[model samples]
Target chain A: MKILVTVAEVATVDDEFEIDGTEIADQYLNADLNEWDDYAIEEAVQLQEGGVADEVVTVTIGPEESEQTIRQALAKGADRAIRVWDESLEGVDLLDVRAKTEILKAVVAEEEPDLILSGVQTGDDSWMATGVSLAESLDFQWSAVVNDLDHDLEDGTASVRRELEGGVEELSEVDLPAVLTIQTGINEPRYASLRGIRQAQRKPLDAKTLDDIGVDAGVVDGSLELTDMYEPESESDATVWEGSAEETAGELAEMLREKGVTA
Target chain B: MTDVLAIADHRRGELRPVSYELATAGRELADETGGDLHLAVISGAVDEFGEKLAREGVDVVHTVADGEEFNHDVYVQAIEQLVDTIDPQYVLVPNSVNGLDYAPAVAGRLDLSIVTDVVDLAVDGDSLIATREMYGGKVETTTELDAGTALATIREGEWPEAEGTADASIEAFDAEIDEDAVGSTVTGFEEVAGGDVDISEADLLVSIGRGIEEEENLDLIRDLVDALDATLSSSRPIVDNGWLPANRQVGQSGKVVTPDVYIAIGISGAVQHVAGMKGSDTIVAINTDPNAPIMDIADYAIHDDLFDVVPALIEEFQ
Candidate 1:
């Protein structure tokens, strides 16, 4: 089985940051592989190591600067990488789920992998819908928020543990030519070793344009438009305990005593 | 038609509370659009769900009796047929794990614009503006959808549940479900958090988060918990990192804890984490970043590093 994982480079804002129009100011933004995708990549890599997957390929829809993040995936274990970008995508403020699904669907058609893995949601946008939407569009079976995936694929069925709300997990089986949105805690993502980082430098990282991928630039022109961005007004009327660590601790202890909490 | 169609969510024979909230949201939008609010109660005990959902603001309850549990394929087909029949302008679904499983497929199949996890919504002329959070609750954003037909998944706790009884028209619609398209089977559900500790039963909870930094640092929190005679709990990341067990996790997917006091240390207080602990009588946040979302709901906040403050707090009790 050939496994394909969708990887995204997400931007995390600093604790104290400035919003430039509809985005966070550039200086306060830090780019890294999305938290959920990190686990997905590890799951795919482990499947390959177990011989259940013949190859593990990663696809990312990001700009050239995202190569650093893509290499992180390759350094860990993916065989190669494919990145799709275009000038048409540069102007888009918010890349809606459909636009992403369309771009990834085109890639899936080209790759023809037996199974696909995507994060349940991106850290930045958190659409939490793309993987299932992609599966539906491609006519593939899918399971969302999967925390565990069984490696035995002899019957072309993926037994997964879907992490439901309120401490419950649903055990389900999805037929192959399937997509599973990987949830965190499925596996521990390994750090890139010195040898793996060296090998990643020589690995294949191919870039494709929208034209090359057989997707129209108009896909970026979706009906969704990001019109406003602002910090939510703080609802806190918190009594800030300001002092040295000792002084603050003293205040907290007094409050606990007053409330009869430290009896 | 300018009508709004909302889907009621259910699991394991009980209707989720978000279903009623969806009704409230659907009614609000329908009123703005000058149309009726139609609620679709699918699967399980359809008649039971429909009768219970026939509350004020719900003009119609369309029930489809299909599978015993939530099957995405069943949902996609039922919703498609309903859309074809009702032609509602907007379809609202709960921004839930199950809703994540199907809402996008419905939108894709129907060729409608889709948005998820929206906290607020408003209808302005021909456009619908959805307010949502991004960058882990650091900022809020508004996205305007001008698409002809749109589907949105609403955040669970954002809207109030529908109240008062209304004489809503309840009707059954038979949907053509393709058996071949249903490729997944839900075997059973396991409660993974059932162990020695139940955080929900705790009184004073000392919850730690990503700010604890290292596993060795957990001893600091443990010491404080021991000193205060409090139960120890944590945000999802600590459990995800394997530093803690599933039972200790406090979040949407874990335990919903309402303690006498919730002392959040280094936790940024994401919406999911907040959902689980916001009901605490007193919220105290101790973190280096004063602007963390936890501080917003905190009754008392100490803007200091947990490393320095936790040891001091423990000493105070000693």
Candidate 2:
């Protein structure tokens, strides 16, 4: 069985990070593997390690630095990595849901893996629809926000339990070659050990552009655009307590008492 | 005139509260864009849901009785037909699990500009701008659709629930879905859980976050819990790390707790996490970051490390 895991590099910026022209301030922008994708990678690697699958391939649509994010996945035990990058994709506004989804669709057409894993959402877009949209466009059987997943290689099907709001969970099954959006906390992601990190340096890290992947550059049009970004209006007026830890705790306990929280 | 179409979401033949919430939010979008509000519903039987939509002040309920349950292809096909029939400038959907599952598919098939989990919506000139929280709700981004026909999923709890007036029209639309397009079969749902600990009922919750540092540090928190006689709970990090059970998780995906006292230690209040516990009578935050979002909702926020605050709090309570 071959499992395809898609990951993306997300920006880590301060709460006050402001948009400078079309993009945010450069100084506050730094990149890391999307936090939610770590769970996807970990699930894929665990499935592979448990002998439930023969291979685990990770893919991403990102810049040159994204190869590093792919390497982090490999360090956690992915067999290889594929990076989809184009100079035109460098523009912040160019790569929208359509562009990203189309890119993944193209890659999936090439891989033809039995199963696909994607993060439920991203810290950047927080859109919560890319994985679902990609699966839909590909016409693949799919499930989303899955917290528990188990596969049967012999039967060529997988059953998953999805986490829902208010502590409800939905259980369903899909045939093999399906896409599943993995929810976080299904399992703890492992750190890259010294050997794994060193081995990742030598693993196959393939980079493909739009033309190389047979995707047109016109998907940027009719895409969702970030017209502006700013902080939301403050809805609270919290009182800050300033004192030593000892005094502060006493004050908090007293306040809780006043509010009838505890006596 | 342009209109915004909202699809009512239902589970097990029952309409969800977010069904009205999305309609409420969509009513504003319709009013702002000088468009009427239309609601489309897909279910094997949506008679009850259809009547509710009418009372919610919707201009029309484009009701479709295709599948008793929500099938991916059924919803995708139905919403596609509804969009074509209405030609609404904006398609507003709820951000529930079932809603997110097929909303994207319809948006993709219709080639509409899709936005998921939007908290705010506005009309800037001819463009439709949307605001959504990101980075765990620490940052707010205002995004716009480059085209006219756009799709968005309204975040639940961000908008008010639609009030009912029982005065609206209903329309029936048929979705042409090929039987072959239904790729997967539902083999009945198995309730994998029940009888587990329900943390939402806890009177006092002593919650910890990444600032707890390690699993061993839970002992320090345990001491405080013992002093305050509070139930031990945590945000996603501790729960993800297996330091706490999944039921103990207090966040959007977890249980919503309205404890009398919620002492959040080291938890940076992400919007998702706050959604579950903002109703607590007293919320105390202990974190080094003075600007943590949790601090905003906290009645008494201590700008100190958890390691320093937990021990002192335990002693004070004792």
Tens-digit lDDT track of model 2 for A150-203: 745568777788777766777776776788888888888999999999999999
Q: What is the DockQ score of candidate 1, to 2 decimals?
A: 0.86
DockQ of each candidate, alpha-carbon based: 0.86, 0.63
Docking class of 2: medium
lDDT, residue B37, candidate 2: 93
- Model 2 per-residue lDDT tens digits across residues B62-160: 889887877777888788878878889999888888887887888888887788888889887678788877666656777877657888888888888
Please state the CAPRI-style docking class of candidate 1: high
lDDT of 1 by residue, A84-106 (tens): 99999995789998999999999
Residue-level lDDT of model 1, residues B36-114, one tens digit each, is: 9999988999999999999989999999998999999999999999999999999999999999999989999999999
Model 1: residues with Cα > 4 Å off, grouped in runs? none
Model 2 residue A237 CA deviation in Å: 1.2
TM-score of candidate 1 on Cα atoms, chains taken together: 0.99
Worst 10 residues of 2 chain B by lDDT: B186-195
